[model samples]
Target: MTLHATAVPFKDGASTLFPGGLPARGGVGLKPEHFREIIESKPDIGFFEVHAENYMVDGGPFHHYLGRIRADYPLSIHGVGLSIGGESALDRQHLDRLAALIARYRPQSFSEHLAWSSHGDLFLNDLLPAPYNARTLDLVCGHIDQTQEHLRCRMLLENPATYVEFAASTMAETDFMAEVLRRTGCGLLLDVNNVYVSCINRGRDPNAWLDACFASIPLSSIAEIHLAGFAQDYDSSGASLLIDSHGSPVARAVWELYRRAIGRTGPLATLLERDNDIPPFQALLAEVSMAEKIMYADAPRALSGEVCA
Candidate 1:
């Protein structure tokens, strides 16, 4: 299942594929708590992203508000259950449902993680890591090809935040992701918090990791950015560990890294994700405002309609 044959070239950048896509600004994850407020107030934001799994059912309050909200803002559907990096063949039934959801909403962008979450029939509710080797690379690329072929739309592959490393892996995570994008022609959803979390856990400098990523991954392939909060913990070795908790406000260090990322990638459709310890809608909007300020402060050209090519 080599998908390179049907891979669409991201010649300029991922944004070029959809002219009327998400604006180059900040967005917040659409939670049920904020749905009513969003519809009533119509907050001035760049876009709204929702997890596809949450809206997989028919005729409910979720769809009721989402239908109304989608009309007013750009929507990005992020899938958490695709298991694109899994060893088994993709679940076609699940894919069909996802496709239906996309068709219903007609979101501006669709994305999934570069990690697997299921094995056999037992579905793990976590995004587990995969070994970065030749076999895993081929499997991931094939899955992305299948997803794109079925959805008839290019999807963004988000980098994962891992607390452990596979000793069997033969390539760096950044290199592996770069190869995946090259082989599949998919866009990237660069999660700055993930970078910081993974690096801090693995005893690497997040800034240097970002530098390495920029050198390998093209700026154009990066269609969106994700900022989230992480919980702090200590491993058995008494070393600091960062968890991708998404339970608090974006940290100061993560914000600094995001600034550096935007300076390089220019203004992208950035997302502020807070899945746990859910805060008030106004609090999330404040974080969104912070992200907007970083984008404009670091890349003023974004206001002039200049983005990465």
Candidate 2:
């Protein structure tokens, strides 16, 4: 499945070679509950994203609905099981399936997390963080390189929403991500909620983290932005802890951060991610609308008449 690197143009910053790429507007995760409604109602969404693992099967109802819905809207495929930072080499069979799925859909975007979810033969269900160091950096870059070569498309790497940091880490998270992007020539799926949750849980200012990212990561490398809601909790030490639980609506604080992010990225494609406590399609669309409004407000000149009402 190894393909030439130049088979798919590498996307960097605002310049893109992929035609009909994901629009710089708001979208939501396409859920089964909302599939029929989406197909029938035809909401004014900019695009739809689906977890790649869900649609890996050869043929089924998931494919049936997705095939139908995808006809009218742009699609982004998000992967949760690539384990790009895992100690073990990637699963070849899984990667092959992923390549097949992407070929079938020809999605405008494809992305995976910087975190790993597997070790050896056992696959974990959670997205775990990796140490920010030279060794881990090289491992991630190699994995991403393999992925791009196999799929023949550039993929976006998402920042993790972590509850803890590795004590042996030698580099900051932003620097690690920047270096990975530089080495692999992949785009970034800047999950703002992950930034807010990880920073709040680690006793750091989220704004400061965003500032570091803006200063380090190239704005063009950021191909997409994700906005989600988090669950709040308290640590054993009585400090506030935030969980990257994609339930509920986008929090006020996260929205504010997203507004700031749009200011820097200049109206990049945004997704409102909700995995648990699924709500009606209208509710998710409302959140999408709110994101569109924020994007337009932050970059009116760039987004004028581009954002759907």
> What is the C-alpha local distance difference test score of each model?
0.88, 0.87
The reply for model 1, stretches above 4 Å from the true place, is 1-19, 301-309
Give the CA lDDT, 0 to 100, for residue 288 in model 1: 90
Q: For residues 1-309, could you state the per-residue lDDT of candidate 1 as single tens digits?
A: 122333554332432223366788899999999888898899998899999999987788999999999889899999999999999899999999988887788788889999999889989989999999999999999999899878777889999999999889999988898889888889889999999999999999999999988888888778899999999999999998999999999999999999999998877899999999899999998999999888888886655665444
Question: Please, what is the TM-score per model?
Answer: 0.93, 0.93
Model 1, position 31: C-alpha lDDT score? 97
TM-score of candidate 2 against the unseen true structure = 0.93
Can you tell me which runs of candidate 2 are displaced by over 4 Å? 1-18, 304-309
Considering every candidate listed, which one attains the maximal lDDT?
Answer: 1
Record all residue pairs in model 1 with backbone atoms less than 3 Å apart, i.e. clashing: none
Cα lDDT of candidate 1 equals 0.88
- Cα-based lDDT at residue 6, candidate 2: 30
lDDT of 2 by residue, 135-238 (tens): 99999999999998787778889999999988999998888988888778888899999999999887888999999988877776788999999998999988
